[model samples]
Target chain A: MKAQRIASLTFTALAIAYLAGAFFIKEPPLRQQLGPDAFPKTIGVMMLVLSLLYVRIEFQRQPVKEDDERAAIIGAEEKLSDYVDYKTIGIMLALMLGYGLAFESLGYPLATFLMFMAGIYVLDLKHWKRDLIIAIIASFGIYFLFRYALRVNLPIGVLKFLFR
Target chain B: MDIWNNIVLGFSVAVTPFNLFLAFVGVFLGTVIGVLPGIGPMTGIALLIPITFGLPPNSAIILMAGIYYGAMYGGSTTSILVNAPGESSSVVTCIDGFEMAKKGRAGPALAAAAIGSFIAGTFATIMLMILGPAIAQFALNFGPPEYFALMFAGLTVVTSLAGRSLVKALLATTIGLAISTIGIDLQSGVSRYTFGNLEMLDGLEFLVVAIGLFALSEVLANLADMRQAVMERLSIKGGLWLTKEDWKRAIPAFIRGTLSGFFVGGLAGAGAAVASFVSYGIEKSTGKHKEELGHGAIEGVAGPEAANNAAAGGAMIHLLCLGIPGSGTTAIMLGALLMLGLQPGPLLFQQQPDFVWGLIASMYIGNVMLLVLNLPLVGMWVKILDIPLYLLVLFIILFSFLGVYTVNNSVQDLLLMVGFGIIGYILRRLDIPAAPIILAMVLGDLMEQALRQSLIISDGSLGIFVTRPISLILLILAAISITNPYWGQLGAFFRRIFGQKTAA
Candidate 1:
């Protein structure tokens, strides 16, 4: 119920922002009957109405009791921390972001190798040797597959000397 | 005679060594993807789109189509073996399939699933061959108003069936349509919401969003619940041959399942998962050995396995004939078609007969390949499950990055994909369905175009949508779909009013 309320509020804000943006869209000199802004404006209004409706419905709904038959059927709502290892996820997110940013500069080989190693370490720290082997093989293997078989151009970066 | 000629041409194209090889590769990879849980056909197709960048559009679609149906065939493997359904559509298979494995009838259970899938796939493909052209011909008469109404109905049906909450599903859809409106408006050549980023000018690529939403989000969700998937070694003692008694019970179930699956799958938003569940229900009520269903009936496995594979074929009908996808995977397939510079509606059949027919022909051959792979190579496929989960997750992430990067080689796109991935994760936590978002995004541009064109034709009159019979009927269907969640309340309300009147 709390999640629904939060989501509704978020969408309501988004709808308002979107409407404001739609309003500011410049009307073309020779605009068609339905201009470029028409679709977005209509969608924005619909979203706003729906978001408000969502808020109303969430508020009107009775909370499920522990002993309720519906509670048994639907089961208890799970907390995020109960199932998810947020620490691992956060590490992964940072690694992926860094990998993307470094992809061209460090090239595919160095960047992918470092990303895989770090990712595997974060996920499973006990097997450093296995992780190292996997990182090297995967990084170089994918590089060769893309470079040779698929003929996709990857950034040479630090690997430019190999071609030379 | 014309149909016969088309079939011949289709076979001629499908039989070419290159196309045949690609079909084999597609089904193989699809089976692997299906055998591994967490990665569905939608993600599988999305992650592989980069490989098809250089191939001809026909070959790429043929390969992807092979994966779509091939996953259906492979989904039953894990269900029977580990009691874990590799695909959502195979959930029913776990009930009886796992029970059969426990009873040492694993071989026959697996065989039933394979044979049923093959039979259902062939039947559905034949039905597609017969109905496809006719439907396309009929839809060729659709005007802009009718097309807009049809797409509107499609989106509503998909949204209504997507999740438990109608508002959340619709909001996701609204967001998708809004995202699609970001690029330069084609009709007027006016920039809508590029926000000064040149990348946004081309609009967000459906492929990028699909990978982020389906692939990356799936990975993140799995990471949260990370645990070692333990597989108990179950040996298939007997040969894979089904007893005559098994065949007798299963044959009817297969027939029933295929029929139900094909028709249900043709409906927008009803895909293999729904069809499989529906088939299971039918088998439970109507099968000869209905009492033995959950315990270990061959019909239980036969029915749903057939239904899912048949649904894969059934989904192709709407995608090929009407240009509307029946499910998330097919929606991605539609995006692929559009990306390949091929329009998938009525004109596609006339213009790209070989491509359409070749795909149809490949399904038949692909079904055979899946059967051969599943039967004798079942052991090898099961071994794939033994791969460490951490490694699997890492590779999925790497491949997703590679696939998105290869699209434009732009770091901005990668960041955008990451951003959507975060949104997808949040939405997942919020219990919002992501499939509707992709479905809406893929169809959004076309829906807007159709709506604008209809308005132009009607000279800005809103009555144009209601004036046309087909358009009006479709709008009615959309209304029905939107009101679907409230139908029980509506029925109760009507009953109360009528009861009061009767009492008075």
Candidate 2:
């Protein structure tokens, strides 16, 4: 069943590829009859033929039995407690969003410090004071490395007034 | 005398303080990225491509090349320690190296791998230094039809070994080709597959597709099964030195693997993965520790490691000589070259000899640096893995976003990056191999341009590819390889005539 689903998806993707190629292309001059459209059209045609072949071959095979039990087993393996670790997607997303928002507004030194702090905090770092100190130092160090040494064009952010 | 002078000139450019530093950075970051499961040299180099864009072309190539070599060394680390391989080339290492780690012989296993890699790498580097120009000259004869045939053969070979339905891989390849069309046509400057979006007019960057498909999908897959992967034997114990018996057993396998890999990986273009598997198979069939094969044989680690590194060297053959990347990692490197507006081929050797030769020389220097880097730096890599997964993922996503956005400072690119991530996840869930898709996309444009150019030169005759001696030989080899496996009885008959026996 999963294989069948995947096969269908591939077919759809190929169709999109073909449609895009055929619709968007233009004709070339007689001297250059192939034009920009020729390669794309060829690939699209190849995909269309291949997708039909795939559907034919797969549909002829015995349909895979969808097992609710197997799905249950997989779900059971993913305990909510395990999903709550520092590796959780939610935490990662939050940290990234925060970093993105803060970086340009808070200046490199301060923003990087906060981002590092948030990064370790999301990692469940218990030593808050130590984390704060290390984050500030590392942030400043990286900022200096990129900005001063490498001459990178890092954002100075809107916090220049406070630092000044 | 001219060649010697060129070599001296290449060395002078390559050994500059900045280029040397860039080389070190590339390899160092490559090794780290390679150690991560589901990440490989392609992604490592892809991420670095943008970073190098602002630099000089030679410096950019040097950095990208370092990442390629560094990733090779880094791939073995995960296999040796965690029983997971980020790249196909390192998969065989997991068999013996992981078993050795389980049995408290991690040190010897790692030592053998390091030594074997150094030996094979040094040997292959020497071969590259001597044979590169000749091979480049030979490949100069490849015309459009020949290149198309070569790419077709590569596609077939990759699909054949894709570990699933060949039809699916072919489908994926076509889909990638289709995606390659989704922007302004290079020749006519007309839009294709834009769905009316201006961002699609530029077509999708292979970099975005590669990162989304490999890195983002990998993260999602890992997220779905986070429990099993949280921690797998956190600490590894054993000295970092190899014993006498370990050395004695590993040395022969190393030599055999190097030669075997250089030949197979060079001609078949199957890359390091096949080389590693073939080496492991040979060691098991012929070595004294046949019984100990899966149970932590030192020969297993040494042979595959040598094969993989030698294959890395051999893979460079296609890249330098023919301008075709034999493996996924090299494809990313090729993409980098294209973005730099430098076409890769025999012309590259002639037009940019300093750039080409200097890049090659940097590889030799980079390999030595990687050996020194990996030996004492094992602990650092181990600690890196232990960093909080959320934080790690967070930084990866953040940096990726920042990197893409900063390139053009456009939010549209970021949205495209996210969209590609979704597509990547979908492809992964379907078990479609991302490698072929990216390969097709990377080479598709160039192949198209070449085809058109050749036709113009030939006044619309298809005989140009067939008339070239070199191209004909390649096409014949491709045909034979494709048919050889199907004609089992014929193969057996020929083997018997030659006094050779078939394996059961």
Candidate 3:
């Protein structure tokens, strides 16, 4: 119930901001059939109305307790935290962000290799030798497929000397 | 005679070695994608869109279409073996499919699903050939107002059917429309919301959003759950053939499922998931051995498996005939067609008969290939389940990045994809669907164009929408779709008032 409230409130704020932004769109010098802001303005109003309806619906619904049917199924009282593993998700998100940041600078092979190794570590796969071989093969195999077979111009970055 | 001629033309194109090879490869990869959990047909098609960039338009569509129906064939394997559906449409199959496997009847169960799917696919394709040209001819008369009304109805249907809450579905739809409104306005040539970034001028690539929402978000959600799958090894004790009694019960169920699935799938919002469930319900009520449905009954597996595969073929009718997609995967296929410089709709029949017919013809061959691949090669597909889940997640992430980058070589797009991925994950947690957003985005620009065009034609009067018969009928449908969920409450309210009046 709290998550639902938070999501509705966030949508309300976004709807307001978007509506305000829609008003600031500059009118074109040449007149047309419909202005550019017309569609956005309509969509903004729809979002606002829908968000308010969502808030109302969320409020009207009964809040589920910790010891509800869901908890009984698991044979223990549970909270939201017990269902989701935030740490693993956080690590995966960080790995993705780092890979995107270093994709061009670190080149495809090195960055992908690092991403795979980090992913394996986060998953707690303890076989280092097998993990190393899998990561190396995956990173370079994909690079070769894209770079040579598909003819995509992937960046070489620090590995330029080796390629040359 | 004309239909016969077109089929010949289609066969001529489909029989070429290059096209044949691609069709085979497409169904092969599609089966692999379907055998693996956490990757549905929508994500499978989105992930492969980049690889099809270099192929000819006809071949590209053929390959993608192969994946669509081929996934339907392969989705049953996981359900029968592991009691887990490979995709949403196969959920019902798990009921009897897994039960049969446990009872040592796995061979007959597997054979029933394969043979039923083949029969359904062939029947639906024949229906498509007979019905495609007629519908396209009828839709050729649609003007701007009619087009706007039709697309409006499509959006409303999808929004109504998606997710639990109507408001949340509408919110997702509005967000998609807002995203589509970015970049330069085509009519006025003025930028709307670029925010000074050159990459944003393209208004966010469809493939990036698709991959992020369907593929990347799935990986993230699975990571959070981290539920390990325990694969139980089940072997087919008997030969891979159905008994006489099994055949007697399954054939009627196959016909019923195929008929229901084809028409239901042609509706704008209803897809294979709905079709399969509807078929299961029908079988429960009407089958000969109704009480045996959940207890290792072959009809239970045969009905849904056939319905889903037939739904794939049925979805193509709307996509090819009217230029509107009936499902999420078909929406992505529509986006691919637009990217490939081919426009689907009425005129496409006249302008690109070979391309259209060739795709239709390839479906016939693809179904045969799928049956061959699925029956004898069932053991090989089950081996795919043994691959570690962590490795799959990492590879999916890598492919998501690679797909986005190869589109424009833009790092900004990669970041944007990750952003959508996070948004998709959040939405999934909230029970708000992501499919409607993608459907809305694909239809957004086209709907807006039709609306503006209609207004222009009507001299800015909204009354033009209702003045035409077809447009008015479609708008009425849209209104009914939007208000469909409230009908039960409305009936009770009216009944109470009438009852009180009678008592008084």
Error of 2 at B464 (Å): 4.1
DockQ value for model 1: 0.45
A-chain TM-score of every model:
0.82, 0.56, 0.85
Return the clash pairs for model 1, or none: none
Give per-residue CA lDDT, model 1, range B84-179, as digits (tens): 787778888999999999999999999999999999999989998999999999999999999999999988976766655677779889988888
Q: Relative to the unseen true structure, what is the C-alpha lDDT of residue B478 in candidate 1, on a scale of 0 to 100? A: 93
Model 1 ranges off by over 4 Å: A63-82, B228-235, B267-269
Backbone clash total for model 1 is: 0
Please tell me which predicted candidate would have the highest DockQ against the true structure: 1
- Candidate 3 lDDT over B71-114, as tens digits, reads 88888998898876778888888899999999998888899999
lDDT of 1 by residue, A1-164 (tens): 68778887898999999988898787887868799899999999988988898778778876423223321222211223446778777888898899889888889889999999888778888888977988888888889988898888887688889889
Number of clashing residue pairs, candidate 3? 0
Q: After superposition, how far is residue B238 of candidate 2 from its true place, in Å?
A: 4.7
Better of 1 and 2 by TM-score: 1
* DockQ-based CAPRI category assigned to the predicted complex of candidate 3: acceptable
Instruction: Give all candidate RMSDs, comma-separated.
Output: 2.7, 6.2, 3.5
Interface RMSD of each: 4.1, 7.8, 6.1
lDDT over C-alpha atoms for residue B195 of model 2 = 74
Write candidate 2's Cα lDDT for B205-319 as tens digits: 7777776666665555555456456557535686888888888899999998898888776556767877888899899899988899989999999998898888888878777
TM-score (0 to 1) of chain B, per candidate? 0.97, 0.91, 0.98
